[model samples]
Target chain A: MVKEKEHEQDAEAGSYPTGQKPKYGPFDIRRYSPTQESKEKRKSNVLFFVALFAIIMLAVYGWYWYNTPGGERQVVQLKNALAPYNPATWYMGKLSQAQDIGNVWSAGGGNETLKGVLFDSFKVAGSEEIPQGSPVVFAYGLKLANAVVSKLPLTLSCNIKDKDIAGDIIPSNPLIISGKRITQNARCRFNSEITKELSGTVEVEGGVIFPFSTTDAKLKVYFTSEEMEQSLLSADEGDFFSYLGIDEQLPLRTAYNGEPIELGIGVSTENEQPVVLREGYNPLIGITLNNRWDGKMLNLTEFRLIIPKELSINQEISQNPNGLCPFTLARQGKTTNEYRASEELIEQVSLEKGRLRSFECWLDVAPELLGSAQYTVKEYEAEADYVYQLPSRTATITVKGVAGKETGIGEDLLSPLV
Target chain B: MGIKPIAIACICLVSLFFISGCDMLPNSIPGFGGNDESSVGGVLSASIFAPSNNGKVLSDYPFKPIVKIKNAGQFEAEGQTCITGLDKDVFSVFTGCECKSFKFEKEGATSEFEPISLEFGSYTVKPQEGDANQQFSAITRYEYVTDVTADLCISNDIYEDCGADPDAGGAIDAKISRVSGGPISIEGVQETVSYTGGSDTVTLIFTINARKSATGRLIPESDLNAQCTPVSADETPKVQAAVREFPITTPIRCRDAEVSADSTATIICEAKDISLINAKGQAVFEKGYTVPITFSLRYFFETVASSKFVVS
Candidate 1:
């Protein structure tokens, strides 16, 4: 009976009576269950395993996120680190007023000497060549040292030494200071006109204090450009004098010396024709004079217009030579037949330096000499004598005469000669 | 084989939950990844200031080097940005770096520009070999963003507002003078007069540059306005060639970009041998008088600079 009870217990526990097969339906499969204590032990083991796995996984992924080679984190770190980048302010040379001193002269003052002009080391910094005709900036730094108790205003000046650079100096601002030490900035726009080296001088002026002396500085350097050399203004030599000197003597007939002046000689008539004289036309000629001396005045004595032998003058052309300043012309000397001008003419007119004066005269052509359709020019030597301060000079002009039919004279003179 | 299907499924689900739960951890945790698109905050500055480049350097010798570090940007924490404060762990740097590591708290803002004495060990150099100089780069990495603007004046009326200081350009006050070449006329003014001075030409200088106040080290990004353009930390401002137009214009072949720390750039436009008749359908500037020139320039400018340096 005890054995039978143990068998029933095993059957109920699903151990199947120590490996005996249980009877089941066609598709049914045999199953087993653990004892209460074993079931509890198994459940505990599963729970422990799950917890352990979770811990291990946490550690692995943690390591991966922390030490991943590259990702958004790296990019962010780089960005932040580079955030404080500073492109340096483009500047050169020391910022002191007296970094370099040049020729400082001081007049007697309460204590300090009034300083002369000073030069500092102000300059542009770089190696890149600037182009000609292109604008470039010449920046510099300045420092002011004031030893006096009162405030002073300073005019910091910059000058481009090379004219070819065509530079225009532009100050960043006026510098007014009362502090012991202060810095100032300035720039110059160098409008380069040539490819040659460029240089400039910077100066500090106008800081005066009774007991304290001020120091000014300037910078000098050659600025190079990459532009091709440009064409320069012509420097041809021309007539340059300061006194009223005769430049050229031109006559209406044949333009004996050069082309006739635009206005007809004497009274300056509009569209005056060629100086060829007919039986009744007036003959006029222009004498051009210029004062080449810059500032000196030219004083004169008596003036004479000598008549040549071929031209017969029975009387003075005019008692008062119109437009011949302060002078009256009249027949003088019977044998020589000279036309002498009044001394007052020379006294009344004085040519200022660089002044241009034109003297035109109207002379009558003897009517008896015009008989042919075209007359050959008669060459004659004429002279103008004048007494100027320090020197008396004579100017001679050749006069050619054309007396004939107006049409025929044009052929010989290449222009109207009446 | 004895395990129930439902129990197995439950175990698998639990495992998956643990694996995916990592995304929920605080960003401060080492393994958790955060949003990649979010902007980072922190301004780091590190640069070399001494031992300027002089074409060549002696080899295998110690040369004086000047290094500097500064907090050029605000520090952001917990979605708040502070200019004067810093984080506890502040910043970390390697000890072996050429420039020694230092903390902002100890160094302070006043000392930001103070140069640190450092030494650079030279290397071999050769002119014939076309060898490059031994470069020294100090990279200060942080997460940051900035906005910058640069104003360029194209017209005469608003030039002062754009960046041109009136008194700064001494004697640059342009006045018309009748030079010998040709006649001159104001764009729309009547009674045109001929220049009688020397040449029939005038030099028109367009002083185009960022405002004097705009040029400097890193400035507050928010201070920028419409005249300014926001540039990435790594970019710089450049003048667009196609958009530049001078009144009596000339070709601008170079200086197309603003220098790193330049306050202004100059463009020279000249009218040479100009004719009495308006050529190019533009009126000539009169002599002995002041004529306003309207200049239009287009440029891209950035106020923020990434880690950068200069040869002393």
Candidate 2:
């Protein structure tokens, strides 16, 4: 009755109230519909079209509303005004604080990425200086503690914090060298290990080297530097043009290790430094001690000294008064001892302790004979390569015995030329 | 006149107007509530005529795209080992470099990942020839990609007590990083724009021939433990998605898309038997429409359609 009324009213008024009418006013709705009613109705088609059309229009208007960077930018800024400031750029802001010395490092990159560098090349560009002391060394060594041996000053500084290293240790802390004196003082401690054995000739310095105890420690030493290299480099081993590395010369890193040791520009000393060469019995010419046993309790019988050829003294200048200087090599222990070679131009060559090897004696000439024989060539322990192509020049080296056995001229002790 | 005739005339006129005026007009749609001045070639963008394309296309309720610039530059190590200058191989690596951005645009704009070829030019460098110290390669290849990026700075130069101690009492000596270069500034875009009805896939690539140069210590000393390793060029590449609704698909046509001022549309879009393949390129999403994830949509229109709205 409601539908009939709706229809009758719809026919007259051209509209229908919500009713059970299948279709009305030329409308037909049915096609792939999701309902059995719509499939069967075959009406309300115009209803579907109208609904779809309305939906599309709503979409069109939405497109014109939001979604543009310009609008977004302003909106984002306004949002930020109400939010907290973000802290992300702080890290990138801290890269300019290097030690910035005029040290603008300059180098070219290679394909492999590692390049050769010269960090301290400019320090000693033009100067030179040598040390002081007797150059020949046959019996003993010097024992100076904590000393600086550098040509240029070095500084260290760090920021290494405790958190930097893995364990709680700080790593940023830099070690800064405040001044030259300070730098030297910090670097005086030298630590190295070297051992040698000598047999041919033995001479021991007395009283000076460790209270002349036979069982006391034997300390060895040496001084080296680029300056030393320049003086003691084998004159025949290199050419002027090839000094830095050619046929005979090796790389600078290699040359540094092989250079000989030297000392003596000239320094005044009345008591003399405690670095004696040899003083007791001329242990070189095969001597036998009878009174007391000495030397590290290990008995000093079968020994061998292996010095490189470059360290041997040549006979060419052995005759010159510039030969070598007077230094003692002794071994004073708890009893009487054996004798080597010494000087009355000086004192007795005491041997109350241990023994030394390959001894040589020299003297200071008069100012008148300065050019002829007034030099002191250091005598080092003789090695197999120390043979003078010429012959052993003669010199009068004195010696003192216990029994008062009258010594021969220069033969047994200073053995002058034949 | 009869009252029924009078009522019928009013209803017919209203329905007719509603049907005629609710058509999409991508090119001439006026602004809605927001201040969007976007247009393409002086033409207003098409309005979204279909109810299906309303909210965010991204699955996430809130979507964010992260961007980052990594290893901004580097110094190659081929030529530095000798007395003579660097070798040519070092320059080659820098010359034939690949600068890429991995991003995915709106699906119909872009979806799924694929390879993009790019060719950039080479560079030649000399010792102290220019303030630049090294020559950079020219971009020869370009590819657009999408990925999520993280903003974490792992500093390599900080020393515990020696480097920069923000919480320290003494002077802080540190090496900080400076973001000298990266993406350029973009002027805000203001032109009518429209994207097609659904998400689209897009892929654009181009080459940038930028040279990277840096100098400092690298291979650590022999006495020092654990040397620094070379940064890999191929590890952990970035992937991101970009979105752009081109005005082409969303045309500027002559359609009146004004929804009835009083009525809102309820749109329901289903998978409708999707024919898409998974990343493995296998057919997927073909099952029947899943229910109750009932994504409810609500929208309003401004027009006299079906007597739902009155004429102004």
Candidate 3:
């Protein structure tokens, strides 16, 4: 009993029993009342951990902010603000804008001014100075503009003032403009045969007003009798002249300003320049009137032709039932005789705008007048009158010399020619 | 040493809280959240993406026509598509329906998806002796609505800074807003204001023009399924226009709402006896009130695309 009481007293006094030892070391006890070094170490660890945590939090917040929509928008704004300072970006932006505008225009979405029929370009595809008896090519282009839509067909017509030169237009008859096509090109070839040097203009007229009317549409050309046969044989054969080295000479010409109405007279004989009068040969005289006005058509009221007294109208040749000029002749004076056009002829023939109307008559020389001479020369006058009260225009004709006898003229003169 | 594990655990808990907090903020905000009703701006664009121009197809063989329709605008469109300009004798459609129906969801919305492709039924080329080329047009007809918002200055004084001049009368800028992208657009706006003894009247004119490229005809909105057929040249298309919102007590009236042959239309709206007073019966003279005027135009629009191909 005394020993048990002593053990209890020892345990109460915090002493281990007999040979038992404490499970902890001296350092464990020191942890309860830490020394300055240990406390300082603990404080330093806490400080390091706090700093680490702060850095990690900062990184996380930064990543979150950068990925946000508002943050991305801010960055985009900064980049845009700096874009103008960079010349390359500025130029690229301008180039893209210009390309967009060009694309819009190509799609026919812009430019209100280009909304009607437009006269695009006019060019003479051949030489400006053409050789006589050679073909001359005139090429012109017309645009229906960008947005002009037409359900009905629009017609285009062109006329050259000189009647002696004639050929087929590429798109003959009515030049119809239809469908969604915006452009049309036309070619006019004139095979000109001339007795003398000539300079004339070809008038083009579109039946519309404004753009078509405002265009000059006249092409002036010169013809020379030199090297006629050689040039005609060597003329370029195609729908259009070759554009190889000739591009430099094909620049568009300036606009023309002149009268819209013109008149020309041509005389053809069986023989060459110096004519020969025989039993069966007669001269054909043609008078051409051109109405270059594009606005409306003009009516014919009267037409009269006067010939030299040495020659008279061939009744069989000039008075054909289906002829263009059927006339009644009256002796005016000793020098000439006047022939008046019939009422049916005046009423049936009306000159259309931008077109030509021709009045032809045949003249026969009296065999008695050509007596005893190698040849004889004569001069005469021709005049015309219109119903629209246009001023009367006149032309002079000079027939060089006519051989008197059939034997005096060559075999070429005996054949029919024009 | 014993405190190290607790410190690491606390740090991990704090990091997790921050990462999770960011995702939760967007859901809590009212207007910032994305919804199915949100809209950007634009209209449906259609293009024939298959069978390239001048492509050759074998005679007596079946071929399919594919159209790409994209809903790039704000409105959900449901329309019918038809193929025209094809010779009935040369080509035969094997499908049961002449015109097929298509539906597309609006863009910039939560339910938006990629552009939907529409495929017409198989077409067989009829046998012919010689190869020939023919032009065919693809037409899409849909009922569409265009909305326009404009702000006009309502002032009792003519010399106010509402872009008005006393010597030249009261003519102000309409301050028209940008129209939503579509086949039709408002070209110009003109406004005129005249003052009476105690009130003022304003006149507004709107000029609208249709896109020239790939745009066909426009008709009235009533019975669109019945009127979406081919239109004659002499028949003029009509649009139903309404003044949805105006600040004045008097109702606004519009006139001359017909599309002309040039693909342009003019609508003139007038408001009579407009008093420049607030709800409290106070005059707004020194500072003019900017009244927002809204217009809604409903019409059925048709667009056509054409291509030429040879059938050998």
DockQ metric for all predictions:
0.00, 0.00, 0.00
- Assess each prediction's global lDDT (C-alpha) against the native: 0.30, 0.21, 0.49
DockQ-derived CAPRI band for the predicted complex in model 3: incorrect
Top-down lDDT ranking: 3, 1, 2
- Top candidate on lDDT is 3
For model 1, the stretches where C-alpha displacement exceeds 4 angstroms are A1-274, A308-336, A379-418, B1-312
* Tens digits of per-residue lDDT for model 3, A302-395: 5566665656777788774234556668556554577767767665655444455666667777543433221222333344444321211111
Q: At residue B170, give the lDDT of candidate 3.
A: 62
lDDT of 1 by residue, B50-118 (tens): 433222333323333344444433222011110100000111111112213333332553433232223
| Tens digit per residue, CA lDDT, model 3, B87-190 | 43355653222456787664555555457667765788787656655544556778766667777676656445576764665665577774545555566555
Which of the CAPRI classes, incorrect, acceptable, medium or high, describes model 1?
Answer: incorrect
Q: Cα deviation in Å at residue A130, candidate 2?
A: 69
Q: TM-scores across all candidates?
A: 0.17, 0.12, 0.35
**Fnat for the candidates in order:** 0.00, 0.00, 0.00
